[model samples]
Target chain A: MSDTPMEAAPFAEKAPDAPVRVLSEGLASWLLVSPLAILLAIFLVIPISVIVTVSFWGYNEWDFYPDFTFENYEYLLTSAVTFDTYVKTFSYVLMAWAFTAAIGFAVAYFLAFHVRSTVWQVALFLVCTVPFWTSNIIRMISWIPFLGRNGLANEVLLQAGLIETPLEFLLFSDFAVVLAFVHLYTLFMVVPIFNSMMRIDRSLIEAARDNGASPFQILTNVILPLSKPGLMIGSIFVVTLVMGDFITVRFMSGSQSASVGRIIQNEIALLQYPAAAASAVVLLITVLIMIAVMLRLVDIRKEL
Target chain B: MDRTETKGVSRRALLKGTAAVGAAAVGSGVIGAPMIWAQNIKDVTLRQFGTGVSNLNEVAEKVKEDLGFTLQMTALDSDSVTQRAATQPKSFDIADIEYWICKKVWGAGNLQAMDVSRIENYDKIVGIFKSGKLTPESTIAQGTAPHSVGFVPEPGARAFADEQTNWMTLIPTIYNADTLGIRPDLIGRPINNWSELLNPEFKGKASILDISAIGIMDMAMVCESMGEIQYGDKGNMTQEEIDKTIAIFIEAKRAGQFRAFWKSFDESVNLMASGEVVIQSMWSPAITAVKSKGIPCVYQPLEEGYRSWGGGLGLSANLSGLELDAAYEYINWYLSGWVGGFLMRQGYYSAVPETSKLFMSENEWGYWFEGKEATEVITNPQGSPMAQVGEVRDGGSFEERMGRVACWNAVMDENKYMVRKWNEFIAA
Candidate 1:
């Protein structure tokens, strides 16, 4: 194969030394990137391509076929249930993101500004991350005993005469699902925000104080603006995680709820691979658009 | 938290180390075919793949000692087992799966038919399974179409070509009925029918399983009991039946009649023990678990009869020659004596009950099989004290329970329709 492009020939002929150096640099860059490129192709690109190809295939009750058909996509697009399920899934994502961001921001702020000692800050930040030590499934299940009808929350309330009747909507409702999601995913929000908050110039806060700005005003004008990149990154994480979740919703809502991911899971369970693949593709596109919007709102590159 | 991060880092490092070693091995041709081929062919490690039901490590150890071949058992969930069997048959040598998976897997040509002549204990399986019909009355009465005969003979088998097929689809293993579990203290009355799961009095206290296939079947039974609809066959519902059943489910769910829909056995137990649900669909083990916590719960015997299921061992289509012979030996060993007795102690019935008797003592047989009051304290499969001297099995005897099986678990023709509707119901 020809090593040089046709348009570059004039430059290469004028400076043969430059062409040799350029070729060597190009080879080094290719060698450096080949391992990561190969990994990405194998793990991400190949699997996504397979899913997309499978989404176009046909399937009957017994098995999937290689025939190209739009029936899977048609069914998904036309169904009323599909729209409703997506709306419900997005509601979960929105709620989870809001709660996680609020909780994560508060915790990160406390560690960065309120805690004076470095050792104390590190130790306390680790404490906020204590739940991450357990598996997601275990963490979700632990809530059952704490929030069930005869669980600690209910019994304590009843004993103290806080209410006339025991609350029946604690364990297996929308409340429990949202609770579990917040508990499991807030860590994603905390780490990025904490990293951003730690990098903020302490002198900026001192300057704001000298200018007679209130704590809330300083937070609103300076700290919030500086932390937008971290907040955007955290939001992307929470949104994608909540949107793609199936197990937490399945277990916590006691199967009373369905996310888009859960719908895909249902199709796979029924041996309907084409339909599942189509649903998965739809979710992937939706998540990508959301992330694109979030990235557009904040230029993380400048901040980093 | 720091410990977890360090542990994660170490795990990643271990994975990278493994990848490096693998790359080196490939570069040096150390894992080449000649090296693999040089080993004794009969010394092959038979890969036993199935759900946790069949992945008893103790049994695998016993098989290895007796047969002088490694039996490597890989446990997966139901969906994953079917997925692997359907897409990658050669990854496993023998498959121990439920009977319902046979039709789908066999139709895909992923499973091979067992030669009845080779299985030494083949003749000893209970007559009910071999015949597929326990009695004339036991046949499904709702369906006009000829019901699917349970023991399916494979293509090109001698029995299928020459005479009535003795070539079985699955060598029968353990089986049991699943029904409603109820908290006795809360109900304040005897609940005897499947309709009680939907009783208005129990609204906000009842739950069902989350699995679409099994959950729909349980709901179908509830519908049939309530005179809401009639089914041609509950196991294989038509599209219209599935739609109607799920619509009813949606209406009920919207009305706030259910507390939750459980996905796992432990979740079901937790629901019962914590008194979140007073009534729900449950497995036998879950019922045992609730009671073990000193909570008053029962695996209620419903008047509509029980939804039953069975599983067994099948050879993969890829295995042949020495590996095939070894698979046959393992299947025979599963039904021989010890494994059956082991499973029977866990409240499941073995195909050859008589063979299981060879391994059990008189007191154990009297308690587990005969359903007599325990003359002495009886231990469960885990050797925990499950019952005192006067306790009895919930449905009476093994024969009484198995004989009352109304329908076997099936992969319905309308599974796609059911799944779609089930999702709608959950969303609604």
Candidate 2:
């Protein structure tokens, strides 16, 4: 009752003016937020909702119809290929994550800690980002000459007498897929990790050192905990990107390997939208589960 | 409020407003046909969605100058064209697509049955193309029946379409026989059969196309040669047949018989040019691409025969009135001798050879159509010298090449299963 009277004092003093002022403030905020909200709803939410809705639909060669059927899901569930593809996709995701996290963390750590000058730090960061200025397809194809049987790597190795013949598996193999993924996605890991490491209080490290903690000990105890959010975010990016990537796998692996995304792409190519949607929904759920696990590990929301 | 109203308009704001208004006017001018019609109706632009096989910007400009209507063509790959046809039917007035896509588009109700009377050059379509099947099986009792798979023929047209057919699905445009492109320097032997794709000697040095519909047919030819399976109609495979064919590919893939599975025309070219792959299923244009690089790439004519695919123009169901009329003019112009000659120069054969002949010089006709040795340098689609003097077109004359079409690239009834299996093979 007392709070109510206190809240109403302004209303009582300036009756209509106060309510109108409050209403206009709320309206202005709404106007400010609307553009982003509308864009999100239109582009992101609507497409996802459509995919979810279509996942339950039935389709033939000619048309996709609005009939609730679990047949698409059932077929996916029963298929051995789906299981194999998911396993392969997950393996790629795991392998890409390990390499990206290690490389990204190392690069980020060096820039954040060692590079004292802000200008040098920025220049170094840009150097890391320079590859991104070009189209990714061109960058991916550039690896062909570097890694091909008669490529620079093989030529160098042959000159060194490391092996008699050129390596066949270097170009169109699982190794190439991981190499391309690391090349493309390590930057995704680096930027966030760098940002997180930048935010780490230097005093915390100094204090840990004062407490007789080694540099390794400081990293494990203080820096690691502080950088959890960035790690989680980077992991999410790498995992999701690797899982959803069809092009890199298609090109780098020379279409010798299949990911879940590739199968969905194949279905879309065949105009099997419902099947593609179902596969997409399953992929989305799988990604969500992975994100949930990462979220559990760090609680990125709380950290941010 | 009175002071605000009295204030002079800022030059920046005035200029911005003027620019916005001008842009809106221009945008509306492009979209609104009636606005153009009110001033001048003769210059209607018809929207065309052409497949990558016939990406002729020069021809489109020529058509605009010749015909009153401007031809705005958007080139798309086959899959994108099919997807667009299915989902966005009203996007194009006409789509130039493959014969396989005709049935799918027709079934989806995206394409309209073309009125033969609208096409001025309809009769000029060749007799063999009108028959639909370039190579109908010899035995009617057991082998697949010879049938025209292009636009459903108008009634009284020969064995190509159903005898009583009245609907025309696609107006035949361009076609060619595709074969395996190999590096002669690496292989150092005469390759004559499709079974060479699986030959252990070339293991880890051969690639196949990544397309399921077309790639599966290529593999089916290999299976036939190896005596693994004999398809009644290789174009259309049953579930068991698809499984059998895919199994052969999977087995070969497991044994490292393939260096890669190529997707685009350029990828095939790159694979051959870079010496990453020794032999692979390649398009005719890809062969030209490799050969242009001064590579000793040969588009080998296998004993099993060439895998052929044909494309033609079809009117969109949503098109009508002036747009439809413009579309007809564009189609007629495409069949006109100049465009055919343009396509012929590019390595694609037009439906009407006579029209192409009229546009071509005697040397072009001799080299391209009659399969005689070139007396002079023969140019590719891009007008680059593809063949020097005395160089003969591979597989001899056009008749010799197209006549032995082993199979047409088909979207089989088991397409879904085949796609799934193909993905499995890729993943495996």
Candidate 3:
């Protein structure tokens, strides 16, 4: 340890301060983030490690034992059901993502620009969240009465002479599953996109207006590119959620559809923990790959 | 609603009794050994968990009244119950579960063999639980029948024995002859056979359970009734049998044969009540729930006979000494009439039907058991009238229904394959 700061300066290389001071600064940063690092290690890493270990273990009808075998993964990778389920799951993710992005962007754009006052924007944003305050299950189940064969939508359509017979496809179909995903998760997209929109410099828009650019040109050229971070974040949220969801598909599609998450859940229900663990590992990788790709597309670090 | 009232009253009574016990323990502390004598009953709290159908809050309250011990009850779905009972042995003291589950759970060694000599109504259990027969003339059903897994050779036995023994795997409690429930007001016809579940007439308005074990059984019922496949044993399907069953259902599913598949009691009720589905697999309580809403539903007796199931209570292997003693006492109280009669009102049979009869009235016994037309309005345990005058129990008397049981719900040896196939059907 050099006692004199001036004497250490010649050998410091790129260091602007004393070596001890630099070490203390790094130590302080580590101290600041250690709690989160420790938490992730304990809650996230340990459980995932156990799951990975269990995935390779053998299982009988009753219990899982510590015998390493790749049978769980082998079956999951080889089976036609697994392939079909992944295809269906990807379709749900695509549909849910597309709809949520479009609707959420429109809503967020309106709130940020057209609302005119921050107070009213906040109040209206709160109004959008009132439906979320009840429950996801209740919201999903409530749709049953509204979209059933003789439900309100059909009855209204009948009275309006919109169609001859009730629409059977409204309630328990792929249409319903996607509808529910949008209903539950559009707010996830809205809040983030709205945040990014609010943070945008107003002078840029004013300058764009001063120019002879069309409103469509201003939206596409100025706003959309700046909102890429928010879009990426919202896409991550929607994609990961849809990928990991089983309940929404189970309830909304009336058990006619299958997803990777549902496969894990079914295995867990049957007490085939090793098989579930295997399926869950596959699902985790799929979701992570999706999130990684989304992250690569846009650096969302600036948005936060 | 009235059941909740009784539960509240009993809870207050229990609090008062606990206070008395505490005061007495303090008073006797001058010459005490931690009041072990007084500590035996009230201090003992047994955690019980099982399927929602049998692990009722009412039963827990009644145990507090009769046994002077706290019975903490948690009710989960059958799959969850099996998962917890097998994996988390220390989490519960007793498991109130189905007999079919016993076959799987027993192998896990989480539950201990119960001493049958301690059961007050051991001899009074129906023959279906003993020799797998309702009568000498009755044939044993082709599933994991109660008798096959009800007993063990010794207290530490790993295997199930068909013979009557001093050690039992579970103390039988509730059972019923299950059949498809139909909307009499909607279907507009007498639905009499199991094959109608696949009939093209109700193509997109039919459903079955999403639970794989029971769903496969129902599929067998449909497949057998349609002469699609002749299974040697529908309960335990071979790989070829499993493949054929899955293929048939997968085709039906692709052709829009199902409106929806249900797992929970409420889902079945909602599917039927909303007319999203007109014919589906349903439970007794679901039919009652529908009828209570002024919807017409019937537990129709098909020409092919009924699919049946039984539920019982078993002690966790971790239970011993005073807690185990209290569990036995609680089980004895359960068999001694009150719970039997309570469950019977909901269209289930008590293990000791004779004792249950003591708790029920002549009219109730006649209506629910004898299948006679109810002379007066018959109410459920909650005291709301469910049946009007001259209405008979669906599927008729105990003998007529239970005697005709085609098979019991079971887990096949090819359960993993069956589950995969079931998932495939859902995907299709």
Candidate 4:
């Protein structure tokens, strides 16, 4: 009777197989999402794979067919033009990033610490964001009227006897390009820093002040340390954006400043897609490495 | 007793169940095959350069109404258009290209052999558009029978009508010879020759297109008229010939003769409008815009004649499959009387001469179409003639412009070098 004790129970149930249930559930969910997955693989994955594969191929001028060759990548690595482009682009991005970050942090800091009312803070932030509503081209063109030889600035300056002749240096120059980049992208930097500042603990600043610290000390010790995540994020945005931009540089730099983007455009125009794709791949790899390094330093996961 | 037996079902049943599931999956794919196939219609996209002239919205609407097809248009520049056509053939269906850009694009095999038979209005096209011995067709295909239709002819602008038919690659859409656009109020004197532009009196007031192709050609014509042998063999010139032409531009730049080097049509118009420039090399559309603003601008015809280019339509390579019939229909409709008339009324001569008669008066047609002498001055919309009698811009039959064209600019080899050099020049 003890050996066959199971016979005593009339309606006893057996334990369910947990793995089978979980697997079945997973299968059902996957079945529901299979269409989207297939679509993504076809449209996104396949095209990107083709681009990456083709980037490795050499081009034939006669048939316009791609042949397998590492020459494109090798040329990019060894060419003086490509190297110079990279160096120039790096410097441009650095300059743009530094300028944007400094200005954005200052504005963000003022709003976060000095501004009291939430409504005014939001209103001021909205003012900064308003220009983002327009197309980049339109915004860039608007600068022409303000910076042209007979533009408002020149007219005013000339009328005020500040200059005898119209300023030719204002419009199609590096200064104008940087000015445009700063005008267009400063918001990208400010929004992130402002968000980060909003998340900073007010009590930390109060504690530093209460412990007989000055405003400078409180800012340097508490505020700056706390805002590193925002600063890094803003710098990354500004750098990546400026690096990839060609139109602004072309319009404002008066064709002298041929950035990497311009070179890619010129190559592509000549029907050199492989060369263009190789250059794009180089840009992508550089950006990825930068992002990886940034993530290692800032632990973006926590900030995000 | 039955529950234990049910729980212990045979493996054969499980095999049957899996087989049924696989069958269902295959069956669904088979049933859905047509839907996927239907979505695979050959879609063609085209890129056209420039903004005001092509007016893609208008073109798209007209195509949709006439041909019952969609033509996606992305407006870009001449350089960008050439680049896309050369690199990404699959990306565009048709390109609105300037006549000069045909060399590079055709040389690169980015263009397909245009089948003239497919186009209904092929027979009615002016004689200049027909292929001669040295056209793009001859260069690209090497003596293969000309297959493409040139809709835009730079009428009366041919440089080498004997050796090569410059009009074969580009069909004439809207063309006006480069006229000496002058402010009569400022100059206070009639300008009858190309030398008037370089007159020291107008120093720092004249402007020219920064592009090397048109500017250099214009200068070559000027030099030729001024008793200089800058252009060899009619208008056909070697690189040395072109270099001499560049010298004039360099001298002008040094002399501060040009108010500004204009890169765009709009910029040129702005220069004239703001009184920053008193005289300049100008296009037809810019003259129209300047006159529309109540400016006393006259397109003065110098003794050397006008330098010009033509723009027209082309078929996409991918158009052969899905929208072949529709594309043909659109092209035919575009060449018909209505569109031609519209273009003519807008001060642009059209490909079809019959359409020009619909909008223009008999006198206007006589002056424009038949190339007959005009009894009266050709006034602007504001009732001002472009120029006084002897100072008229090149006016003649479309065939004349297409036929007598001096040396068509060397766009493939020398043009690329010139464009790059121009960029360098701008940088300098």
Give each model's whole-structure lDDT.
0.79, 0.80, 0.89, 0.63
Candidate 1 has an lDDT of 0.79
lDDT of 2 by residue, B4-99 (tens): 664545665565445544543443343222222222223466777867778678876665445544678898877888888877887887788887
The number of clashing residue pairs in model 2 is: 4
Q: What C-alpha lDDT, on a 0 to 100 scale, does residue A159 get in candidate 3? A: 94
How far out, in Å, is residue A69 in model 3?
0.7
lDDT of 1 by residue, B1-428 (tens): 99999999999966655554443334224212111221233356899888776588988776655444578999987777777777788798888887666655666767777778776666777765665545545554221111232344564332222223656667878878778899989999999888888888988888998777678889999998989999889988988888888888788888889998887777788778877789999988788788888888988888888888777887788888778766776676677777888877777788888889987877778888898888888777678877788888888887677667666777777667777777788889
Residue B48 of model 2, lDDT score:
79
Best-first order by lDDT: 3, 2, 1, 4
- Deviation of model 3 at B56, angstroms: 2.1
> If both were scored by lDDT, which would come out higher, candidate 3 or candidate 4?
3
The C-alpha RMSD in Å for every predicted model, in order, reads 10.2, 8.1, 6.9, 14.7
| iRMSD, all candidates | 1.7, 1.2, 0.8, 4.9
- Candidate 2 chain B minimal-lDDT segment of 10 residues: B138-147
TM-score of each: 0.85, 0.87, 0.91, 0.66
Tens-digit per-residue lDDT, A108-157, candidate 1: 89988999999999999889878878888999988978887878899999
lDDT of 4 by residue, A1-304 (tens): 2333366233233534333232465676788799999999999888878878778777532124658888878877876567667777787787788788889999999999899999999999998888889999899878877887778999999999999998766775667888889888999889888988999989988888899999999888988877889888887888788878878876675444567787777656555577778888888888879878877888666865
Q: Which structure among the candidates has the greatest TM-score?
A: 3
Candidate closest to the true structure, highest lDDT: 3
